[model samples]
Target: MGNVLGLESFYRRQLRQLLGIRHPRRISNAALYKRCNARPLRYRITKARWVLFGQVPRGSDRNPAFMQMARYFDSSTEGGW
Candidate 1:
């Protein structure tokens, strides 16, 4: 069991070293216990609106044609005539 544990730790350290990653700091059990006992925060998303915020629509003639088709289909389904 000891040999297996040692080999596992050794391999983990070797993999980290090869990947240039630092070992994380060890946290004490008491600190973990305190964190578990802390109160949780209440969060809510308020006053939110969606906005188009990506690359501009390509200037292809097909783009507007597809959009117009979609809008027409939606209006017909919604009884807008």
Candidate 2:
């Protein structure tokens, strides 16, 4: 079989490594996004969840989770740019 791994494969592998999921399985990206967005953050800004993550609504780069995922996703593309 030709290589079946692609972006979603990479994403799943990385997420499993980062989230430490024991079982490798199929998942819906939309579901993951919705669930993350729904979880109550500690705070908010202008009635937005970005504040819960201490971000300034599309103006901040302080989310640790975001930073980590960025590293995992982009590090290979540009040698971390």
* Count of clashing residue pairs in every prediction: 0, 0
Worst 10 residues of 1 by lDDT: 40-49
* Tens digit per residue, CA lDDT, model 1, 3-62: 555655565555445545564754343443344452212111111211221222333436
Model 2 residue runs over 4 Å out of place are 1-5, 24-27, 33-81
RMSD in angstroms, candidate 1? Answer: 14.8
For candidate 2, what is the lDDT?
0.50
Cα-based TM-score, every candidate: 0.28, 0.26
As for candidate 2, its clashing pairs are none
Best by lDDT: 2
TM-score of candidate 1 against the unseen true structure: 0.28
Error of 2 at 68 (Å): 38
Query: Which stretches of candidate 1 lie above 4 Å from their native place?
Result: 24-81
Cα displacement (Å) at residue 79, model 2? 40
Native-to-model Cα distance after best TM-score fit, residue 31 in candidate 2, in Å: 3.1
